[model samples]
Target chain A: MSSRIDTKTKILDAAEKLFAERGFSETSLRLITSKAEVNLASVNYHFGSKRELIRAVLARYLDLFMPAASNAIAELQQQHPHASLTDIFSALVSPLLTLNSIRAGGTRTFLQLLGRGYIESQGHLRWFITSHYGEHLQSFVTAVQASVPTIPRADIFWRLHFTLGTVVFTMASADALIDIAAADFDEKNNIETVIRKVIPYIASGVAVSA
Target chain B: MSSRIDTKTKILDAAEKLFAERGFSETSLRLITSKAEVNLASVNYHFGSKRELIRAVLARYLDLFMPAASNAIAELQQQHPHASLTDIFSALVSPLLTLNSIRAGGTRTFLQLLGRGYIESQGHLRWFITSHYGEHLQSFVTAVQASVPTIPRADIFWRLHFTLGTVVFTMASADALIDIAAADFDEKNNIETVIRKVIPYIASGVAVSA
Candidate 1:
């Protein structure tokens, strides 16, 4: 990458890591600039303000996620013209599961960022997410409703909510939970195992009647 | 209440509101003390540290939640000696739904605090929650497994993970989602509606097989 692009990437990298660890308000611009090895002026020049910098950090992550998710959904729809609810659901979530596999440390960081976004309410990232991805979520909800006409629309929304919570939590808190429940469970970092384990539970919940 | 006890209560009330609005890190001891109309020395003398003050805020909320949830579960177990999986599921969740009915601002604050704890990570409140509520979760899982024998234990764990995410998100961000979707629907603040809407989706997700 050119020096200009490298600076932008470095700012994003430092911002994402710090945002994930300390959240938006707690993290200082100085910390991000120091970590990125760029002058303070670069952040303001590239992103305008710390708030915009936070938005940029989240946008970079989402830009990577949205295309992959949209393509996976499109491909699945084509492959299974008469796909069951489970099939569509799998398409929607499987891409996220595979995100970690696309690169080293990518999945862990993504999951961490996601969990932080959902759990922390006061961050600028929250506004960015709702504004950018709210429509995408509505689209997913519409597709699921179309696939499973029997399920109530309200229930569909709620199940989607729960499914997200579970996915983000498992990704972010798995290591800690594992430490707490130290039993005969395998210690593998298999993302597939996580996906397979969660999909059914979410599927069953969404499929069941109130 | 005695003057001393009243002052302590005021401090807690202010702290909870501030923490919920600005987060634990961004909200300062000075802000909290001033909001409570107590002196800086009072905060130091009463709570010893800001960290402990945060814990006290959470502990007060959980103290209300834990007993109600436990009682509801106990009542359910007694009422139906052979309750189906759905009944068991309702027993576990219904009490939490009722938490919204607690005094006007209480539920929102509680939800905010819970969301903050889950997302922020590395806190005494998080430790307090997992240690106290971990077994309750495990037992609920066992009931779920017994009811749905076909599902694997690992899958149940994953579904639970999703269920938690959904619940927290809905409780914390429902207003935001409602605002965003205001054109499509009326904004109502009924917690029962939320519970009724969510239960079946989550139940089906957990019960259905892949």
Candidate 2:
């Protein structure tokens, strides 16, 4: 059972990489199996089909990112109890930044898949994200509402949408943007620097006046 | 020559709509030419191949959007002479929001394609954007730097990248995000409302203290 889980994870990791590099349409099951060092039967047994495999790859991200992110935010909510908008926003974003730093490659693939998935709106994957991660987002929205009781509930979601967009886009474009920044401005920018720089912009947006 | 140009625009427009709906890989030349009421020979004559057609579809957008967005920002820069961060940001976003309202379906499809093209980073399309639109973005960066002269140019790029990410993501996820917002918040928010709500958030991010 443990080895099965391990194989599943390895396959997912490989799929994420391929999908990121080649995209959903171009990425083939054989390529994923080859990359993962797993057999086609193993792939079929685990994920059933390419689309399901894509969902599993995406689901793996939520499985890791959502719980960790929500847990951190909940802890922050509990600790401060009267946390400001910045505190709430920080709790939401900092963990992601940390996750990126520690699991850099995985985070990059996840970011790439995220931007692609959302843009592609491939029906099944789209449904998987909304259904699976919807509650996690709602909790953050609730926390945000508590932090800024003045802002309307709808506005909170829109702001969260903006926040996710910023995070996802930055993550997806990380390499290109960093390279351009280095070339144009002669500054050494990395994921950590980007994460740090973006938080304030996002937090300020979350804290914007009605 | 004029009729030829019209036929080309027609094919590009159809390709844009299909690509936005079905994605680049899934969308084929048959689908595009059929939708455009043009023949295969016309498509080949106009753009050489599907990939070139895709490039042409994306190129048409930059041809329109860059000039309009850059001109708006430049005019704002000159008119205000020493505009505030919000003013600079407003000049950048308002034109787009207005364009969204006026064009409605066309803007939405274009936004979808833009997000996809940027994320997919399809080799030719990516090069087209970077080399072609790089100057437009640099001008915006210069205007932003002038507007917020205190902020580091590198930081300005990061912030601007964040802004673009947010805009592109939100635009790409337009229908889905709006649906989620409406379902979660129970308010019937439309594209215009999303645009109006987003500008302030992004503008505040731009206006964020150094």
| Top candidate when judged by TM-score against the true structure | 2
In model 2, the Cα lDDT at residue B82 comes to 94
Predicted candidate 2 versus true structure: per-residue lDDT over A80-197, tens digit per residue: 9888877776675555555565455666677778766665554456677768888887677778889888888778778887998898778767777888888988889766677678
C-alpha lDDT of all candidate models, in order:
0.68, 0.76
For model 2, residues B1-210, the per-residue Cα lDDT tens digits are 434658888898788878887777678888888888888789899888877787788777667778788899989977898987677766755555555543556566777787766666534565777688898877887887887877776777788879888987887777778887778778787666776788789888977884
Quality class of the docking in candidate 1, CAPRI style: medium
| Model 1 / residue B128 / CA error / Å | 1.1
Residue A83, candidate 2: alpha-carbon lDDT:
84
Q: Give the TM-score comparing model 1 with the true structure, all chains together.
A: 0.83
TM-scores for every candidate against the unseen true structure: 0.83, 0.86
Q: Taking the candidates in order, what DockQ does each have?
A: 0.57, 0.67
TM-scores computed on chain B for all candidates: 0.80, 0.83
Chain A TM-score per model, please list them: 0.79, 0.82
lDDT of 2: 0.76
Worst 10 residues of 1 chain B by lDDT: B180-189
- Candidate 1: residue B14 lDDT (0-100): 88
Off by over 4 Å in 2: A1-10, A20-26, A92-104, A123-126, B1-7, B93-104, B122-126, B182-190
Root-mean-square deviation of every model: 3.6, 3.6
